[model samples]
Target: MTTNTPLIELTAWMRGRLAERVARLIDAGHDPHTGPDLIITPLGTTGEPGTRADRSCDRCGRFVSQGCILYMITVQAAPRVLCVGGLCGACRRLEDGWQA
Candidate 1:
């Protein structure tokens, strides 16, 4: 028999992991209402190109410079604040193992 998890299951798993991560961020002083609201969108979706300067990877705390591929997460508190959290390329690739 073939061994392949369904796409739906993989998607759900990713979402759950992301939720847990966000919760951890909140617990680690990244609370949306009390701290900067991270507004993470796709790289191109932000109407800009390449990665943001001086933005570190929220997952591993690695310094990320421009031109590097990144996956960002957004933490928001409505009309209060907006900021961005990110994961460097290495972390992003590592996270891919979550599907397994």
Candidate 2:
């Protein structure tokens, strides 16, 4: 359990960053759900660590090719910590007012 503290902290930090970005987008009159400029850092994997492979975007259900950037999202819904891949960078930044 203690070994996972760092990963948990990292996840929390990432979530906070996402929240801030979303707030900024909202203030700018943009819909965050339609933007892909948000950064998604991959935390520790649910499978073997350090192993890389192609994955699908959990949000849009699109296949993400290898070498493409995939965002890692961790959702805590009580009694469960669901980790899933989010949109690819291009898809994530498709909306106006997206930074980066």
- The model with the greatest lDDT is 1
Please give the lDDT score for candidate 1.
0.47
Candidate 1 lDDT, tens digit per residue, 1-100?
2223323322343455456655555676655344443433222123234444336665566766766665774433222333345677776655455522
Where does model 1 exceed 4 Å of error?
Answer: 1-54, 74-84, 98-100
| Off by more than 4 A, model 2 | 1-54, 90-100
Against the true structure, what is each candidate's TM-score? 0.35, 0.32
lDDT of 2 at 56: 55
- Model 2 per-residue lDDT tens digits across residues 1-100: 1112332333344456445545654676755444334323333223343333336543345666677777654543212132344556654553212557
Give lDDT per model, in order.
Answer: 0.47, 0.44
- Count backbone clashes in candidate 2: 3
Residue 55, model 2: lDDT of: 63
User: What is the lDDT, from 0 to 100, of the residue 86 in candidate 1?
Assistant: 60
